[model samples]
Structure formats: C-alpha cells, structure tokens
Target chain A: MIRAQKIGKSFGPLRALSDVNFEISQGELIALLGANGAGKTTLIRILAALTRPSTGTAEVAGYELNREQQQVRKRIGVVSHQTLLYGEMSAQENLYFYGRMFRVPDLQSRIDELLGLMELKKRRHDLVRTFSRGMQQRLSLARAVLHQPNVLLLDEPFTGLDIHAEELLTRFIEKAVADQVTVLMTVHDLDYARDHAQRLLVLHKGRLAIDAAAAQTTRAQIVELIRE
Target chain B: MNSLQQIYTILHKDILLELRSKDIITTMLIFSLTVVVIFNFVFEPGSEEMATSAPGILWVAFAFASNLGLSRSFAREQENSNMQGLLLCPVDRSAVFTAKVAGNVLFIFLVELITLPVMVLFFDLHIGPVWLPLLGTLILGTLGFATVGTVFSAISANTRSREVMLPIMLFPVTVPIILAAIKSTSYLLAGRDMSQVWSWLRLLIAFDVIYFVVCFLLYEYVVEE
Candidate 1:
C-alpha cells in the first residue's frame, strides 16, 4: 500500500511538488500522468525514499518515508529513467549483486528466471555497457524485481524503448500485478496507460488534477484534463 | 544479508570492476610513480636534501594518487544512478562506507607498496632496517587518509565540478593525518628508535580513531538524500 499526506517539495527557487495527497490499495496498478517538470518523478523519488519531502509526509509498505527508510526500502522496487545497472559488470553480475544485496532466497535460480523472463539469458555474460538500450532497460527491470519486492515504482520506463521492448515491459508489469505487487508508474503514453493501468492519477502544476478509472476515462478527456 | 556480508559484497564488486577496467589502480599507480620520479629529478637523486625530503615526496604522491582513486570509485556509483540503487537496499548505510574505505585503502596501499622500493632506490635511502616500521606507518597513515577521504569524496561527488570540489573539501579535514604521516614517515626514514616517532605515531592513531568514528557515525547523513 502507498499513502501520501499533503506532500510538498521545493528546490531553492522552484516548487516541484506541493500539497499532493493520494492513496493506493494493495495490488492496484496506478499510472501517474504528467508532462515535464510536473513532479511525477519527484513523487516517485519521495515514495522510494531516494529524496525527502520538504513538507508533508509519505508512507510506503507501513513504514514512514523519513523515519524508517530502510524498512521502507526493503518493501519496494524502483526503476527510473536511470538504468541503475553498473556498466562494467555483466548482466548476470548486476542481478546477482542486487539479489545478494537484498538477501533474496535462492538468488542464483531467481536471477536465472528473471534473466530468462527479460529475454536476456543469451547476453547474460556480456557487460552492460555493450548492450543496447533495450537490453539495459530489461536488465534494469531484472535488477528491480530480483528481490520480489512488495511494491513497485517505475518512472517513465517506456520513454526510450522500442515498441517490442515496451510490450515486453508491459507483460512483465502485468505479471507482477497478478502476483499482487502494488504498482505505481509515471507515464506519458495515455494509450498504453489506458490499456494497462487500472487507475490513472494525473498531476498538473504539482497538484493532483485527476484521479479516475482508466477504462471509464477516455484518452481525449484525459488529454483535455491535462491541457487544463 | 548481514552487514559484514553486505560489506564484502560491495568490496568484491568494486574489486571485480577495477580488475576489469584497470581504471583506478592503473591510473593512480602511473600517476604516483611519475610524481616520485619527478620528485627525484627535482631534488636530485642521492642528494642529502632528497634523503630528508623523500618521505614528504612519498606522502604527497600518495595523496594526489588517492584523490584520483577516491573520485573514480564514487564516479562508478554515479553511473546509471548505481549509488541510489545501492542506497535503496535494506543494508546499513555504514556498510557502503566501510566497504568503500576498505577498497580505497587496498588500492592506495598497493600504490605505496610498489612506489616504496623505487622511492628508496631513486632517493638513495636505506630501507632495509626500517621496512617493518615503515610499513606500519604507511598502514596507519593510509587508514587515516581513507577514513576522512571517503566522507569528503561522497560530499564532493554530489556537487558540480566534483574534481575541483574533492581536494578542497578533503585537504582541510585531513590535515592532521597528512601532518602525522609526513612526520612519522620522516622519523622512520631517519633510522631512529621507534620511541623517537612515538608522539607522531600516537597522533596518527588518535586521528585515525577520531576520523574513523566520526565518518562511521556521520555516513548516514552523507549518503542520505
């Protein structure tokens, strides 16, 4: 589960997110929609405990963001625009390192399964830097899920992916949600979000401008809402 | 995993990466060796002045080379937000700090180990009688340097112009270590009894403990967002 109360964040001269509140129940697939500088990534960073909120509070997986960050971290997985994979290490090495770091059980088998799931088993021994962007993104996903975290947070995961890669990522997310992992992702592609996300949460000017069931809210209306 | 296990995992990862790239160790080794050779040219090999100054030159070379290694170590984490990824784990923050400190000490110590004999030969000093004491001084001094350097390296890594930021933040805080190392090293080189450098050794140990404890306690803040 995820909860935020009056979350506000600011850089010295710029306000990135302000007075935003939202909650998601277990296994809910929620997509956060916003344009550039709309605080989508900032919100996810706060949830991931990667950054502190200047004002208000956030709790993820029953742990307070600021007070119990380690516990919070234990329960969540994050995949951002940054791949977070070490280029110097091989794909399997990256997964092994994170799996061991998170104390995952039977890590070797789990890594193999994820590598196969990401279609990276063939390239598992190659260094990350030598891989294409799609391969890197897939490995990044493998790294995030290596621990089988209770919650998943992704920021613009489909940004640079080709159509095939995007579809692969979508299938993986669906599988994760089926396994009852609470999912929150930031997205620009309303069509993909409409088809894949059960709920849509939109942000504008650091405010929660829209929250609606994805199937009921047409893409045209969502676009108009974003424009407003 | 337990904190010690986590520490080994991190240290192992760094060592493997370094082995593959040969980036940090190779760069620091070449840079330090060049500096020592240059110092030989500057002070004139086998000169009496070079004998008195070799320890100072050694520490200076080690210090400059260390700065490069520290910068490169953290810079690897900066790649692809690997640092954030590491921080997101449930492990203690100090595990990351301790692992990095150990890795840096290993790399810098290797640099010194190779540089020392060349230093003795080029500077024309007898190291046979004092090798053990010299090794002890190098270990203590390197520990002091790595403890404080790790913290400053993290602080500077997050800033713009990180290359410029590292030395400025590092040098002031490490003054005690650098001073103690230079004095202790000089005394060791002079062929005096260990008691002659006791005061400097004590200072080095004291500073090493202080810096190590401070860095351990404060590392959470340094790495936190």
Candidate 2:
C-alpha cells in the first residue's frame, strides 16, 4: 500500500532522509522508530503527499506522490500533533465539514457512527475549544478516519494522552489495523510498538538502519539498532 | 463532487464558525465606527473640505477595517493548521480562495450596511437620488477589497508577522480600487448625475474582474505547502 524507493530529502545542508527504501503491504502495521532528525516525519510528510522528495519517487495506494497528490491524499489519512480542526467548531461540525470535504458517501450516517465510536456523541455539540486535550486528540483521530481512508499515517499519535485516553486510541488504531487499513506510525513508546505493531522500521540520521518483524525483535535490539 | 460543492462546503463552515463566535463582525464593525468617529474629529462638519474628503476617508476606514476582519477569519484557520487541512482536500486549491473571498465579501457587506448610515449621519452627506448608484459603488468596491484582501490574507497567513505583512503587500495593489471607489463615491455624494460617474464605475468593474481572476489563478501557489 506504501512504496518509497530511494527517497531522499534535503533542506539546505541538512539531509532529512537519504536513499530511503521501503514498501508496506496492505494491512501491514508498522511502528516507525527513530530519533529526532531521523526523518520519520519527513518520510511521513512525503508519503502523505504533503512534501516532495528531492531525489526519489514514492507512491501511496497506487498513486504517485508528486504527480497525483490529490489522488494520493484522498487515499491516505494523517494525524499529527495539531488536530487540524477549528477550535470554535463543534466536534460534529468538524466531522461534517471534513465529510463534505472528502465527499464521503452517506456522510451523515458515517459521522454518527464515528461520533459514537469515538465516544464523543454526548459532547458532539460543544465547541472543540471547550473540549479537554484528550477529547480534542480523540476528535483529531476521529477526523482522520472520518473519510474511511485506505492508508493511515500517524506521527506521534500517542503523545499527550492519559492512560485511559491512550488505551482508547490504542484500541481504535488496533481495530483500524485489523480492518486492513495500512498503518505507518512514528512512535517513541517501544513497548507499545512491540505489543501493537507487526513490524519495526528504524531510522537514524536520515537513513534506514533496520527493518525487522516485531515478533522476532526485542525492545533492547530495537533500541540498539536506533542507537547505532 | 465538483469544485463548487467543495467551495460551498468550505464557505458554509467559515460562515458557521463566524456566526458562532461573531468575533470578526464585531471587530470590524467596532473598528469601522472608531475610524469614522476619529475622522469626524479631524475635520469640521459640513465644510467643503470635509464634504470633498468624506468619501476618501470613508473608503479608507472601510479598507482598513475589512483588513482586520480578513486577518481574523484566516487567524481562525491558522489556529489548528486548518488551512493545511483545507489544502489536503482532493479538489483544486482555488476553491479555498473563492470560498474565503465569498465569506469576507459577506462580512464586509454587513459591516458596510452598518457603516453607511453612520457615515451619512456623521458626515452630513445628502443622499437623494444617487442611493442606487452609491450602493452599486459600495458593492463593487467591497468586491475589490474582499478580492485583493483575500489574496494577500492568504499570502500573509503563512508569514511570521502576518499583521505586518498583509498591509505592506495589500495596500499598494489596491490603489486603483480605492481611487475608483472614492472618486465615484465623491461624485455620488456631490449630487452629480449617475451618468457623469460611468467612467469611474467602469474602471471599478474592470479592476474587480482583473484582480478576481488573477487572484483566483495565483492562489494555488500562495497556499501550497
């Protein structure tokens, strides 16, 4: 579902990714492991069709990233630190707005299902500014998946969550994975990655350092690979 | 869905958000009134000078006040990177510019609806038969304001000091609109026949068309990440 062949990105003298090569099949849940400046977000941005690689080509869901950006964007969903939702808008309004933006078929029913799924039904009418951080984060996830995208790109999805909220997000992402939504997530929580992700891809200094099946790898081994 | 439907979806969200907060309208309305009252102090009542300068002062107040509203509306989108969200939609990015232009046009029109009577009363202008032509001038002028304002607003929204960048880039480009609107308005306020102002009205329409199409076409590059 995701392919990056020799993808390289540079900003001035700094290289964010160098000759990165990888392919993620449909339903493959990947926990992208890396340090800061390791190009996880850069790679995610490229695959999400938000940024272009300087030297190589990439594709998402059969659409080339550079040429078919709109098509690629329609197939992929992204969740980042910012929720990408209007604070003054209600959760329901936010979803409805995205529903129409994505032209999701049967939009109202899908919105209702998402509200219930995210446990935001009771508070759907309240402005997002009044929502707690955890609630806002949950709504962000809900907005990402609202379009029913084929690919999910998550950058630090587990940050700023209380135990309960984290667990809720964990369950949501797991379900998305089980349903064959291609998932590539950048996460710092190695234990969480080991437990949830089927494969571990590590990056260091804008280069791919390791790629291994999660079940065959230990937390120490992954950490050692990243440190190297 | 076609781009119009996407444009409508964005326009609806912007209007809905503005309705709930009323921040942009309130800010614009109050700012306009303040500009008018301050100008009221600068010149004595009913002097030939004030009478001649009133249209210029009024359009200046409007141009500046509408900038405040345009900035605020985009500031709302900038809050959560919602502009980025809008860009990621699978439609042509020009829809973003059109929808925002429509929203700002509505807000600027509402502000003018309040400001016009206040302008008339405050400036002691005679509005007999020229009201229709006067309203036409206002709509065309506001279209220009909302048009160029929407373009520069998108441009500055990406900068570090948007409030500083907007006026710097916006003011010079809109000289023709301000000049045309002020001249036509001056003619209207002087109780001149509408036919006498046809040249200026044509100029305003021409400026509106040129800017609207150029801004629409150039918008994709401005807002691209």
Candidate 3:
C-alpha cells in the first residue's frame, strides 16, 4: 500500500532522514521502532505528504507521494502525541469538525458510530478540555479513523494512556488490522510493539538497522540489533 | 468535493462556533469603541479639523481593532493543538488558509458593522451618500489586511515570541492597506469626486488580489512540518 525508496530529508546542516527505504502491504501493522531523533516522525510526515523529501520518491496508496499529495492524504490518517483536538469544543464537535473537513458523507451518523466505537458516547458532549488524558486520546483515535482511512500513522500513541486505556487501544488496533487497515506507528515501547505489530522496522542513526517479522525476532535479538 | 466546498465547510464551522461563543465580535466591538472614545477625548469632535479627519481616525481604529480580532482568529486552534487536526485532514492546506481568511473577513466585517454605527453616533457626523463607496473600500482593505495577517499569524503562531511577533511582522506588510484605506476614506468623507478616489480604491483591490494569491500559494509551505 506504501513504498518509499532511498528517501532522504535534510534541514540545512541536519540530516533528519537518509537513504531510507521501506514498503508496507495492505492490512499490515508495522511498528517503526527508534530512539529519540531516530527519524521516525520524519518518515511518517514524509509518508503522509506533510513534508517533501529532499531526494528520492515515495508512492502511497498508489499515488505518487510528492505529486499526488492530496490523494495520498485522503487515504492516510495520522495521530501524534498531541491529541490534535480543539479543547474548547466537545469530543463530538471535534469529530464533526474533521468530518466536515474531509467532507465525509453522512457526517453525523459517522460521528455517532465513531463515538460509540471509541467508548466516548457518554462524554461526547463535554468540552474536550474537561476530558482526562485517556479520554482525549481515545477521541483523537476516533477522529483519525472517522474517514475510514486506509493507512494509519501513529506517533507515540500510547505515551500517556493508563493501563485500561492501553488495553482498549490494543483491542482497537487489533480490530483495525482485522478490518484491513494498514497501520504504521512509531513507538519506544518494545513490549507494545512486540505484541501489537506484526512487522518491526528499527531505525539507527537515520538508517534502517533491522526489518523483520515480529515472530522471527526475540526480545533479546531485537535489543541486540538496537545495540548494534 | 472541490476545494471551495471544503473551505466553505470549515469556514461555516468556525462562524458557527464564534456565534455560539460570541468571543471575537464582542471583544472587537468593545475594543474599537474604547479606541474611538479615546480619540474623541484626545481631539475635540466638533472642531472642523477633527471632523475633516474623522474618516481617517475611524479606519485607523477599525484597522487596529481588527488586528486584535485577527490575532485571536486562530487562538482556538492554537490553544489545544487543533491546528494539527486541521492539517492532518485530507483537505488542501490552501483550503485552510482560505477558510481562515474567510472567517477573519466575516469577524472583522461584523465588528465593523457594529462599530460603525457607534462611531457615527459618538462623532455626531452625517454619513454622506459616499458612505456606500467608503464601505466598499473598507471591506476590500480589510480583506487585504486579513489575508496577509492570516499568513503571518500562522508563521508567528509557531515561533517563540508569537504575541509580539505577529504585530511586528503584520504591521509592516500592511502599511499599504492602511495608507490606502485612510486616503480613500478621507476622500469619500470629504465628498470629493469618486473619480479622484479611484486610484486608492484600485490600489486596495490590487493589494487584496496580490496578497490573497501569494498567501494562498505559500500557506502550504508555511504549515508543512
């Protein structure tokens, strides 16, 4: 569903991503594992068409990443550490706002379904500013999936969630994969990645260090790869 | 859907929110009235010279007060990282720019509508038939100001000194709009022939078109990560 070849991005003297190449097929849940400043977010931004590469080319959802960014954007959903929601508005309003932006058909009904799916129906009318971090995170998840985007890019999505929230998120991800949505997420939690991601791609110094199926690698081996 | 429809939907959402909260318009109206009152106290209203300069004073007040509105136009988005959600949507980034410009225009115009009657009442000045032409000039000038202001606001919103940065960056670029608005406003107020005022009006239109197109094109680059 997505292909990036020798993609590199640099900011003046700082190289954020270099010689990066990867691909993901439809319905695969891939974890982008990297330490701080390991170019994970940069790669996701590039794939999402939010940033243009300094070199090479990428194709997402069969559209050229740079040339057909709008189409690529339509097929991809993104969630970062920030909930990216309007705090002054209710969770329902936030989703409705994005639904209008994407011009989703039958926006109200879609918002209702998403609210129920994210278990936010009870708190849907309350201002998001009043929400717990966990509730806000769940709302963010619903917002991302509202358009039923084919590809999902999550950046540190589990950072602030409590255990219950994490479990709910895990179930959501499993269901998303079952529904045939391609998932690419950046994570620092190896255990979460080990359990959730079918494939793992590790980044070291802005380069791909390890790309393997989760089942093929043990925790010890994965740690050894990171050490190398 | 087309980009225009997408922009319209976003703009409609913002306007509905503003109507519910009454935040931008209320603040802008009160601020503008205070400015007019301050100007009145500083300059005697019945004096011939002061009456002659009333149009300039009115627009200057409107311009500055509208800047306050523009600053807060994106406040809701910036408050909780709502801008990221807007950016993540599939809509074109330029659509975001267009929607913001439209929203600012509406808010600024609403403020002007409310403030104009107040200005006329306090200043005790008769608005001539030329008031219609002057109103057109104000709208066009406001459009130009808001277009560039929206772009600069986004740029400054990400900076360390956003509060100070926005006015510093915006005021300099908006000199042309302010000058033209004041000039044309004074001409219409003085009841000068419309022909003579055409030059300033044309300049306002030209500035609006130029900045509108430039800002729309550059917005994608400004907001991209």
Candidate 4:
C-alpha cells in the first residue's frame, strides 16, 4: 500500500503540488487524472522516491518514503512516456541489464517470459532503436516489471500507442492488478482510464479535486470536474 | 548483487559496445594523431629544445583527445531519451556515475595506449625504464580526468548546446589535472628521480581521489528529475 500525508512540492515561487493526500491500497489500479502541469508528474516523482516533497511524508509498502527511500524504490516499478531502454542494446539485453541491477534471480528466463508476454519474442534480439514506438512501449513495460515489483507507477503509459498496443497495455495492467500489484498511472484518456482503472483521482492546479471508486464515477462528471 | 557488480555490468556493456563499433577509439586515434602530426610539423624534432616541449605536446594531445571521447561517452544515452531509461533503474545514481567514469577511464587508457607509441615515434624520444611511472601517470591522470569529466558530461548532456557546452564547462575545471599530469609526465620522461617527481604525482593522485568522492556524492543531485 502507498500513503501520502499532506504532500506538497514547490519550485522557487511556483507551487507544483500542495497539501496533496491520498492512499493506494493493494490490488487497486488508480488512475491519476490531471492536465499538463497539474502536478501529476511531480506527485508521481515524489511517490517513486525520485524527488523529495517539500513537505509532508509518504509511506509505501510499509516503508516511510523519505526515510526509507531505497526500500521504497526497491518495491516500486516505473514506466514513463520516455521508454528507458538503451537504443543500442537489444530488448533482451536491456531487460537483462535491468534484471542484473535489481538482482533478479533466473534473469534470462524472466526476460524471456516478459518478452513472450509483451509479444516481443521475435524482436528480442533487435536493438531498441529499430523498434517502433509501440514496440518500445511494450519493452518499456517489460523493463519496469522485470523485478516483479509490488507497486507500479506509470506516467502517460499509453501515449503514442496504437489501438492494438493500447489493448495489450490494458491487458498487462489488468494482469498486474490481478496479481495483487498496486498500479498508479497518469492519463489524459478518460475513456481508457474509465474502463481500466479501479479508482480515479483528479488533480486540479496541484490539489486533489476528486477521489472516487471507478464504479461510482461517471465520464461526464470527470470531464466536468477536470474542466473546472 | 552489490553496487560494484552492477557498475561492472554497465561498464562491461559500454566497453563491449565500443569494441564492436570502435567508434570512440577510431575518432580518438585519428584526432590524437592529427594533433601529434601538427605538433611535429610546428616543432623541429630531435632538437634539444624540442625534447623539453614534447611532454606538453603529448599531454595536449591527450587532453583534447580525451575531451573528444568524453563528449561521445554519453552521446548514445542523450539520443532518444536513453538516459531516462538508465535513470529509471533502481540502482544508486552513483553507480551510474562510477560506471561512466570507469568506461571513460578505459577509453582514455586505450587512446593513450595508441597515442603513446605514436608519441614515441613522432617525437623520437626514448622513454627509457620510466615506462612504469609513465603508465602510473597515465592511469592516475586519466582517473582524475574521467571522474570530473563524467559528471560534467552528464550535466552538459541535458543542455541544449551540449556539444558546445561540454568542452566549455569541462576544460576549465580540469585545468589542474592537465597541469599536474603534464608536469609529472615531463619529469618522468626526463628520467628525473622519483623524489623530485613525487609532489606532482601526489597532486594528480589527490585530485583523482577528491573528484572521485565528490562526484560520487553529488551525482544524485545532478541526476534527480
């Protein structure tokens, strides 16, 4: 589970996130909804242990976010719009590299499984630079989950993906939640988020404006809420 | 696995990539040789005065060639947001810095290895039994250069004019390493006694230790998103 209490972040005179508080329980797929510059990325970075919040505390997987950052990092998997794969390396090599970093046992078979699951088996040996955007996104997903992290954070994961790729990603997210992994992602596509996420949290001008179970929320309501 | 092992894996990957493409090595070699050839023509060889200046010429070639290689070290990562991929790994950011320093050290050493033979041939200067000291100087000097260079290269990699910004930022900070390295190399090449050369060697070693530790500590700040 991930919990943030009064999390706030600022840059000089500009405030990014202020007094933001939320909790993500195990097996919950939470979609973070915010327009550009609405603090989704900042909040995610703080939660991912990549950036320190200006105030408040975050606890993830029973570890205090600020005090036990390493532990928090170890429990989390992340994928952003930037597919963090090395362009010169093959998809398998990139997975192998990350697996080695995370100290995953039986790394080769783990990589193979991820490649097969991502439908990248035939292209596993090809350099990431040669792969199309959708292919790279799929591989990026594989890289993030290489260690089987319990908590996953994805920023704009579906960007630039085709319908087929989007379907694959949706399936991946569903399986992740089925396996009891806590998933949090930011999205602009309300329809996709509406169908996929178990909960929706909206951010407006760096403050939480709406938090509700997905089943209770309506697309029109979310659209109107964000538009405000 | 430990942090060192992770660093080793990354370093090994970089080295293997370089070996396969030979891109960095070839450019460094050609550039270093061109600088050496130009120096040879500008200064008459085998003259007593020329021997005194050879050490400076050799180091100038190395510093420039090293900068060339350092700039390219992060080029692959800069392209297509690969750096973000590397950063997303849960590994300590310092490991990234260390791996880059090690890779740059290896490339610089390889370039030195190629440049050394050519320096000897072009300058007609016999290095004598000072090979050990020369080798020590090369390794230590390269360590200092790579330690600081890796940090600044990473900094410049994020900037708009990375190609122009790297040298401007790197050269000024690295003046101490270049100076100490050139001084020590000159003393060693001249067959000076160990006692006389000890101070400059100490300076090089000191610079290497300080920068290596400082850079390791400060890396997390530079890499933080």
Find the candidate with the highest lDDT and give its number: 1
Write the number of the candidate with greater DockQ, choosing between 2 and 3: 2
lDDT of 4 by residue, A1-228 (tens): 999999999889999999998999999999999778889999988988878899999998889988887788778998889887877788888888889888899999999899999999999888888999999999999989998999999999999998888899999999999999999999999987888888899999999988898889888877886777
TM-score of 2: 0.93
Q: Write the per-residue lDDT of candidate 3 for residues A95-144, one digit (tens) a residue.
A: 88888777789999999898898888999889888999998899999988
- Candidate order, TM-score descending: 1, 4, 3, 2
Clashing pairs in 2: none
**Highest DockQ model number:** 1
Worst 10 residues of 3 chain A by lDDT: A219-228
lDDT of 2 by residue, A1-228 (tens): 998999999988988899999999999899999887789999988887766789899889999887999899898888987889999888999999998889899988998898898888999999999988889899999889988899999999878887877989999988998999999999998998888898999998999888889988877877776776
Chain B TM (all candidates): 0.97, 0.95, 0.95, 0.96
Interface RMSD of 3: 1.9
Off by over 4 Å in 1: A215-228
Ranking by DockQ: 1, 2, 3, 4
Per-residue CA lDDT of candidate 1, range A50-114, in tens? 87899999889888988998899989999988999999899989899998899999999999899
The candidate 3 chain B region of ten consecutive residues with least summed lDDT is B42-51
lDDT of 4 at A41: 91
Cα-based lDDT for every prediction: 0.90, 0.89, 0.85, 0.87
Query: Compared with the real two-chain complex, what DockQ does model 4 have?
Result: 0.54
Q: Whose TM-score is higher: candidate 1's or candidate 2's?
A: 1
Question: TM-scores for all candidates?
Answer: 0.96, 0.93, 0.94, 0.95
What are the per-residue Cα lDDT tens digits for candidate 1 across B60-144?
A: 9999899999899889889888999998888888899999999999989998999989888888888788888789889999999
Q: Candidate 3 or 4, higher DockQ?
A: 3
lDDT of 4 by residue, B17-82 (tens): 787678888888899889888888877768877788888888888888888888888886766566
